[model samples]
Target: MCNEMTTSLKTEVLESPLEIVLKGSNTKFITAFKELLLHPVYSRPTLQFIESSVKLAPNRARVLAESEHGRLIFIQLLKQTESWYSGEDNFYLHLLNSIISQLLSADLGNLFLSTFSEPIVNEDERLSLLKIVDAAIDSLLERKSTTLDCQPLLEILFRDFTTASAQAIPFIRSADTSPEYSDSLLSQLTNIWNRLIVLLDIYQTILDNQPSLKPEILKDNIIEELVSLLGEAQKSLPRRSKLADLEKSASKSSSGNVSDHDDLDPKDFPLIKGKIIYLLGTLVQENKQVQDLVRQLQGLELVLTNCIIDLNNPFIRERSILCLRYLLANNPENQDFVAKMEAKETVSEDALHEAGYETELVNGKLALKKRT
Candidate 1:
């Protein structure tokens, strides 16, 4: 009966989207609204109806989320809209975002997020879904959205990231094979890098909205993995940067799988590294527990090592210094650990100067260097 109603209404041929009108809450109304959205003109009304219907109340949203009719409407959204639409003012994109936000705020046993957490075979589909999920998380944070349960949702996000890391790190290893392999590695790395970008963006948004959750975020011993990954990423940077140039020299090849707008360049390691530093800094900022966590993991150097000039990553040096600051904030152990860290051999002043730093002398002796 439900399928029949949806098929009949969606099959209606209308000259204008304005022809459709949403009436009482019923199967026919839901079906007609799905068809109406096919034309962009009725998108706003459709979005409004979804916001009111699925998000009528948290309880109602959950109940509806469980209902066959509600599930059908939600499924229609995936078919009707694309999450990749750009611009701040696109209603089609806004509608997609609004729907995810409402579902998350309702949180029905992490139903909305759980769908995303599961393994997705198609990389493009996973990336698209992740983008929508990221947008939804932004809305939740903006509204200070709460739900009956969020830990499950949070855990799902973490798990999804773990999955992404597993998928991407193997590709990162391909960078070490040979210089000639640069083009293929860069193409492969884009998918991984783009996925990391959104996941990191989502994590930053979550922590930004609720600074108090920092301890909770670190309590799971996530810092250990993060520190290890940061080390892995740093190790890969110089190699990948070199490979990028080698790739450009060889050919301007392209990958059809990745989006052109993402500007997925091979040498963009600094961007990913910088984001990791920022996320770590945010997590450790004014939070003694996470600060100590970093100290325990011996990850302070990950941030400090990045405290150098890299033209590719515009503000990465500053971000690295800031992350170190957070790592050292009121933590004597971390401060001392950083203080004791030294180069394998003594550095010459000319070398420092060439690296864009002016050495600062303690009395008559040089103790530190600052960016000139």
Candidate 2:
């Protein structure tokens, strides 16, 4: 009778939906599964079983992602786990590490990307997902051993995010008339931009802690696309008159609320542009190939132009200048490029001087000559 009951229970669990098992409370199976998840032994078979289940039922994994309880449980486990080197108390960390590896193997990471690509109805929930994904990335990056495989996850993240951002650019450029419509578009753009920032943060952390990961990041064409996006963003900044019109409309509104026009703030454009410049700077700071690529793409000109235009904003100007310095640093081709640009400017000024006008370098600086 005892053997028969055990077999029946096992059969019942096998037949039940995966999400129910994951999200259900206090059942014998859930308690057992939770133990397996937090198991101290890194090579336990039960852990493998759970991983296989997720792999086999990736749609169920998406279901878990959609559930607040499921997400919180997973995040809590990750938070409680110390580093892998934390001796005997590192069970949760070990389990999470394995779980991430399994998720990648099962192609569930692609499912996560697909879910992320969908329209986010809840901003807080979307942020929670971002945090969970970032945590998984952090866990992989924390490994001291060389065996961890983070490339696949990184690739999916980069490809999906860039593609999504590219898709959003057109809607942003359109700048729809309805305040509600415009706000929605800007919110989408902001969410995508924030997600990109999170990814870039992970990349920077990897580069800082594990220099070997830099090549994998660079080879993905992420930087090239980011530079292109930055140029487009700069070109799309709202004109001063358009901003004034928005201000006038805001002032005339009965509710006396300018919240609708918050997304149209001219300053936000420069801030986003500055961050892109900083990202480019970070990418090229230690990578010669990226430096060459930036030069080949005429990124130097773009950075310089933006720097000049936003000189009044110290942060924007500083970031742009730093990016230019990185792109040209020890780069002979880029140096020559800058030198030619300066030479052309000099020739133009000399031509004016030759036309019977006095030109002078005040304090060794080029200054326009006044007709005297």
Residue-pair clashes per candidate: 0, 0
lDDT of every model, 2 decimals: 0.59, 0.56
Measured against the true structure, the TM-scores of the candidates, in listed sequence, are 0.68, 0.53
Which tens-of-lDDT digit does each residue in 147-170 have in candidate 2?
445555677767655765676567
Pick out the ten consecutive residues of candidate 2 with the lowest summed lDDT.
Answer: 347-356
Candidate 1 residues 1-372, lDDT tens each?
334444454454222121132222455666665665564556566566555554545455553345555555555665444442643567667766766666666555367555433341245555666787787777666664353234555676677677767766665555445345466656556656777888888778877776666666776656776776677777665522455653553353353433322343453443677778888888888878788877777677667667665544546767777776666656766644543453322333343343344444456544344454
Error of 2 at 184 (Å): 4.0
lDDT of 1: 0.59
- lDDT score of residue 259 within candidate 1: 36
Best of the candidates, TM-score: 1
Question: What pairs collide in candidate 1?
Answer: none
Candidates' RMSD to native: 7.6, 12.1
